[model samples]
Structure formats: C-alpha cells, structure tokens
Target: MNFSAPTGNGGTALLRRLVWLRFVAVGLLMPGLTIWTSPVRANPHGGSVVHGDIHIGAGTGGHLQIHQGSANAIINWDSFSIAAGELTQFLQPGTSSAVLNRVTGGDPSAIHGALQANGNVFVINPNGILVGPGGTIDVHGLVLSTLDVSDGEFLAGGDQVFKGASDQGVTNLGRINAIGGDVFLIGKTVTNSGAITATGRVGLAAGEEVLLTAAENASGERIFVRATGSGVSGTGITNDG
Candidate 1:
C-alpha cells in the first residue's frame, strides 16, 4: 500500500504533523469486559513503508505508514483485537489500498474504536471481509469497505485494476454507524444483516440543552418525554432506542 497525495494538498501534509502518538491500555483480557482504558499506551509507528504483510495487536493502536512516503498500510494479521474506551485508531491509505484480515475464526474478531481508515480500505483473505455478531465499525468519519465499485477518489478495489481478484466479498453482520461523516461500503459483494445508521447523530447534539423526565401514568403505558426543535425550521425528531 502506498499513498502519495497530489500537490497543493496541504491538509494531508498537516495530517503528517499529528506527531507519532502512542496508545497505551490497562485492562483485562476477557472477551466481554470493557476494562481497557486506552488513554495511555504504546502504539508503534514501525516505519513509513509497506513491505508485504502488516500486523496490529489487540493491546494498543499505532500510527503506521507504508511505502516510505506513503502513509498507506497493508496489514496481514493472524488475529486483531481491541477492547473499549476512547481507544481511537487512524489507518490512512489516502489513495492507496489497505488490507485487513481475520485468519483463525469463522466468526470475525471484534475491534473497538472509532476504527477509521482514511483511504480505500481492502479486506482480503480466503475468509474475505466478514464482520461477526459482536464486531462493530464505528464510523465517525470516512469509512471505505470492499463492498462497491471503486471511483478512484476514496475507494480503490472492485475494478480489478489495482487489486488482484474480485472473488472476495464483504459481509457485515455487525453494526456500522456514522457519527459526523459519510459512510461508504465498497465491495464486489455485500451482505449486511446488522444496522447501518447514517443519521449523523446519536443521543443529542453538542452544546444542546435538555431538561426533561420520563414518568409513568396510571395506565402504565410507559410514558416518556419527546422533544425536538430549538427554533429551527427543519428540526426533525427520531426516536430509536
């Protein structure tokens, strides 16, 4: 995987200035325990080159690059895992192709974050791109999956031009949600049994004020408060719990 931004793209140069941030974690190793707090840990920026295979552990998240100048990454892992907390990871391939795989499980392993990929992300292997029941992809920004045809902008597969074969597909049996950015799932084949919420919002907006309560009535109909609008014209209300 290689990333070479076009000239005059100062924003990408600024992205390089984020410094090599190390992610540290402290928690249990159980499957369901949300015990890891990744506020502090060591995540390695091994190099700025994509040699062949890339591997990321379940302990900490790192800022990695490929092809020297290209910040793109090609990871070949036996297993990838992450717990919970504000453990964020940024896997940027820009215009390059990136690979993520799960080797041992018919059920896809779980990863936690705002797990992000800044460029066209590729999920390849005999297993293909499969997200299991507990797996989730929290897309706070751009999310590129191997589920659609590539347009050369944010996705780069499915055309069989850069990537080798198109026999592999993507299956998301988990959750993929958008917090503040667009969500794009690109692959030759896509099967989504989970939820894909691109509403761009969760509970409330930033700096919003809420003063309400939930009370029960004599009929026991589970009465709850519902409010939407702050003097805005198209203030919509969506109730999904």
Candidate 2:
C-alpha cells in the first residue's frame, strides 16, 4: 500500500528537524544551538518480566542484559530509554523467540545508544518512541510502535493487533537493521530520516489500529493499518532518507 506524505504540525516539525540535521552534517553548528539528546542512560530500569521466564542482569558501564527462557516473553517497564553510549542486549532462545516490552510510566522512550537482540523485539510506548541520531538497533526482527497490545493477545501468538488513542508518534533518526527479519514501525505519526536495512519487508503504518500478520516465510510478513476509520486520522508516514 502507498503511504501518503506526513501532514499536520507534527509533520512540519519533523521536516524541520530533518533539514536541521542536514545542516549539522555540513559542520554548521551555531552557538547555543539545542541538540536533541536523551536525558537518560542506555540502561533500561524498572523492568520486570511480567509474563515469561527471563533473567535480568546488569553489567558494568551502563549495560543491561535480558535472557529469555520462554518462547514469548512480556516485559513491563516504568521507563525504557538509552543514552548515546549505553547498551541493552537481549538473548532469546532463538531467532523466532519474541519479546514484548511495554512502557507504562507515561513517558516516551528515547533510544540513542545500542539495542542488540538475538530475536524479535517489540517496544510499545503510548507516549511515543524516538530513535535519536546516534541510536542503533540490531535484531532479528523489530517492531517499534506507539500503539498498545493486550497481554492476552500478545501471548496468544498469532497476528498481533494494536490499537491506541495516543496522539504521540514514533520517529527514527538513527540506524536500524533487522537481520533476515522484518521491521515494522506503527504510530499515529511515523517518520524515518535515517537508515533501515532489513532482508525482509519494512512496513510503516500510521493509524490508531494496526495489524501485524505473522511471518509466513523467511522473508517476513505484512502490516495493515486502517487509515480512514473514525478517530484514525494520523500524520501519516514520512521517510526522508
């Protein structure tokens, strides 16, 4: 499906940021210029395994690791963020293992460091999700959304449906690579001005309700979004890179 260009004030702001980033690339740094940076470190805090058997550990120098024993795991976090030099690693059982990370502390997640996962990783934050300029994500599969999915539906292990009323959106200004997997970005507004490499499909859906079909082959699956329904107007999707 064709995604229209981003509209509304949010879209305008994103375009402006993209332009400013271009200026930054040319070594144009004005005095007192404000740069966007995450206020937190790379370590993810206040995380608990809510629906699976997992081990959480910390290492020196702002590193966090999660070892999952279950095929599907659900983790709830008060806040999930990463700074420029921090790292969060996930060790799953296999490439098909999936982890759902839901942030409930009414704050957006800013990922600016590195997030490495052996399997699929889903991050849901109603406030929003930002992958800043220095951020990097390497995973088997990745889903970054501002939508909400129920725990029952998540563990049921079929096509995952997400719905939410959040006005905030998801933005990516860094690098995301899904090795032999798909990358899905869903939100009320979705913008990508960085690099995204995936052997499978790259789906960007903007709406209140989104459907992520299960992968059928090694390539990946599809993403569907209801764009014209009531209360489903969004800024749409923008990819400047």
Predicted structure with the largest TM-score when compared to the true one: 2
Q: lDDT score, residue 187, model 1?
A: 30
lDDT of each: 0.31, 0.75
C-alpha positional error of residue 134 in candidate 1 after TM-score superposition, expressed in Å:
1.4
lDDT, candidate 2, equals 0.75
Pick the lDDT winner: 2
TM-score of 1: 0.35
| RMSD per model, one decimal | 19.6, 7.1
lDDT value, candidate 1, whole model? 0.31
Over the stretch 119-195, how does candidate 2's per-residue lDDT look in tens digits? 99999998889898999999999999998988988888787778888877788889999998888888877777788
Following a full C-alpha superposition, what root-mean-square deviation does model 1 have from the true structure? Answer: 19.6
Candidate 2: worst-modelled 10 consecutive residues by lDDT: 13-22
